[model samples]
Target: MTSQPRPGPAVFISAGEASGDQHGAAVAREIRRELPDVRLFGIGGRELEAAGVSRIAGLDELSVMGGTEVLRRLPGFFRLQRRIEGLFVTEDVRLLLPIDYPGLNLRLARSARRQGRRVLYYIAPQVWAWREGRARKLQRDCDRVLTVLPFEGPLLERYGVRTEFVGHPLLDAPRSRAAAARDRAAPGVRMTDSRRVIGLFPGSRAQEVRFMLPVFAEAARQLARRHQDLDFLVARPPHLPKSLYAGAGFPTAGAREVTERSWAALTKSGTITLELALAGVPMVVGYRTGGLEWAIGRRLVRIPSIVLVNLVAEAPVVPEFLQDRLTAERVAAELEGLLGERAAGRREMLRAFDVVRERLGDPGCAARVASHAIELLARDQESPGRLGTPC
Candidate 1:
């Protein structure tokens, strides 16, 4: 009997941040399901590990955010990149999938390409948001790019990058299994009898927590005062301490810390909006950052929508409260509307969300990405000197 052709090509993935890790993990799992013998390994966090990916390095261990933070961690980042680049040369990794953390991942992709490895950028960078020129470099480096946004494809095309709009992964996952869960009756802290749950997601970064958590807590207090019967749950990432929320003044005693349990999430922007949508948990999204950061982002951001649900749905299905507008009063009002099943706004939003969820395509995004990587590997081997065509 043949030895299964030595399993398939070895594909390496690198993802940073909680959202990237989740998306990367989904892709890795799908690849395994599609090609049972495919060799998959990566540098990721708990999400990829739980998805059965072999860890080359823990992404969380190397995470640094914001311009100033990244500058502070430059030496360590360089060290990690060198180690990753060394792995590409010595391990002979045929293909590389670099998920959203464009700064670090882009550099790694460039290094991998230099070592003659095919690169597929899963969850392409938000180049359209700012630094649109990155598209040129991406086209020069990567073999293929998979974008979840419909608008991103054309932007990448201008730079001659090969890109595909893989339906948003949020549309693909199983909805949160938790039923109507209402066990809380107050805002600062309260207990309820109903199973209807409200998700509060401050964010993954400490800075975000600093800026948003207190507002979120105050909003929850207001929400509890008005509703008095909704359960509040926080989907805490492993990187954040449970005490992180305590100082923010959101009662943590009865509030569930849903690391990997229950469903529905009230999260910051990015992938969580999509996750909450996929989970079928209706949410009111909110975000807050430093004034300087907001001003800088405003000048750079291209899109009008901040919520991923709106971006994926290409319309507003969920209300987004950002910056100064993201207050306890605003959050409470929005949450009240969503939790109020009879509210027409809530009905309309949920109805649109149902349609959006179906559009996410299939649940095997990571697998499809994996298969794509393997195919690229084969083509690369057939023509070692060819550069991939831009999208």
Candidate 2:
């Protein structure tokens, strides 16, 4: 008697924040495009929901940021870990792709690997910055570390990990200011004045908002005092209530649903900086943390550049004021440099963004990542040992 064939492999994904959700959704969509029959499920948010990923748990609850805050949510985090581990054991997913939530995703990868599932880590954890030793741990746990930055490849290779620079996801975004300008033409809300828009991106995390919004508001007030023609838009995160900003004393043009084009942002560093660069919106990056966190991080983080644009360009294409430097005066000064003067230097920086855009390779990162995850699953089928029985 002929036996029935086993079904196509299932791929599980875990993306904990809005940015991860965005990247994960894109990857899921690409996965669907490439392998229509493969079952895809796991934890994600609205973007992943739109991308056809069935959710095991919502990301909103897991969106805590910073060292102390993450410690506060340890109980909830452990509960989520157990749930993912349960899936790895019972459901036996063939591949697990943890997008960017390293703290959570790294643990999930180790758990999945123990259960003999192939693990592909996309957006390699910032071990180069803080926990450099985790590179060895990742090399041990993950099947392949797919990094977005060019420099990360060499760094991880030094640790004997299989790594790939699949190009940055930002490159795949709409990179032309003209494209953004065109997209804006069809907008519903009419701005009081479209002359020059100043974006305020406090950040997606509540702690970031707590630290940055007041400073950003003060900077905005300073900007308004100097130039009244400029309009201000705050890029609010989905998990946050509009009242949060209102409570912070930030004057919003009423809380509109935050979109990619909310403003020419005074951004917090990370993926959003790359997004703004691709969107052709000029920005000044800022970051601040608790004093203890800052002191510890200052000692540990070895990289010269913290913001993605700076790292990708291997130079300071945009201003980054971090820690104590992230003050209203510094932010306002940088903002003035970007918007106030419109000097040749700013124009040159915008031109440099074009090169940065070219380097991002393509917006097909989600699709590429999905395809790679499928390949890893297939490889796992041929040799189960390869998932963890590393060379």
Candidate 3:
């Protein structure tokens, strides 16, 4: 008897922002490592490309943030979705991996499901925050919701999605300490010093850069007045123009590098805050959205906190300044307090970080997702997208 021929290895991944790029790259990297012959293709960034994924669409093509940004980029989103749906049919896509960027992924999931394809949504959408109705739609559209956050499983499962809390992808990321020691030259300037470092991550989206970088720059300027020994490192995400951070006037580095070196930081409220937390860097999280968007979100969001570190720990270890509260003076003051708040204060915060570490589960998240992908490849379910258990 002859052995059956192996199925073609093709997985479609979509990651529309810097954070997703970083994450999707890791999963792609792991999938390649585990199954050497597997082929990965997607819409992602430089990181994903480096991880061996062939990009049909660049991150810049789909990267948009804020309600206003999404509205303006609607045509581009539709075009990309249609093109991806076509690829699913043409390439015989075995599995669909949509890493965050829900607005587009949900539609893509719906289309892929119509094609009788399976979708594993990494970093599940914030239906818990707003649009609770979509949770059920996600269940209907996806085979498995591979969430990184601990709270998502219970919430999404309650709504009927087959969910798995695969810990956070950041847990499997390369150590900040290992690479932070290198005084590498990046988009802006090079860092070479013994002085302590403070990271200023204003966020990776263009809208976030526009709304937050000036405030961060001014705060950095003020903080420099008092702490002359401190060094500032800003993370410049891929696809952004070099001029984007030109006014910030600080040495720029990759986020992972800066997170390792920074003793304390004033960062935009997002996934970077949680990455910093995992690295044991105490932070003051800040964010600003369009006035109308902020007002509407404030009413709709169910959670009391926006900072992921605080949400994951179920404690206020990281301070947050949002919208009207994200003023330069206040941010500078918070950073000052965080840096000089005494060694014990930093130790106490780091101790709380231990809780965050525990909550995120262990590393090897991508490896597990890779295993799930392999299983999906073998099993052809004519029913909905549901696969087996998360392991």
Best by lDDT: 3
lDDT per residue for candidate 3 within 161-216, as digits (tens), equals 89888888888876664234332323234345547788899888777888999999
TM-score of 2: 0.90
lDDT of 2: 0.77
| Cα lDDT tens digits for candidate 2, 1-391 | 9999876568898988887887888888888887778778888788888888878888678778778888889998899899878777666688888987888888888888788788889999888888888898888888888888777889889999999889887666553544355235533444444566677888887788888888888898898889877767777766777777885454454212322444456878878877777766677888998998888888898888788888878888888888888899888877787663346655666677788888777566766787788788778878876666642
Off by over 4 Å in 1: 1-8, 32-39, 179-195, 249-265, 385-391
| Candidate with better lDDT, 2 vs 3 | 3
Among all windows of 10 consecutive residues in model 1, the one with the lowest summed lDDT is 182-191
In model 2, state the lDDT of residue 383: 84
Higher lDDT: candidate 1 or 3? Answer: 3
Candidate rank order under lDDT: 3, 2, 1
Query: What is the overall TM-score of model 3 with all chains considered together?
Result: 0.90
Clashes of each: 20, 4, 1
Model 2 / residue 352 / CA error / Å: 1.8
Residue 211 lDDT in candidate 3: 90
Please, what is the TM-score per model? 0.85, 0.90, 0.90
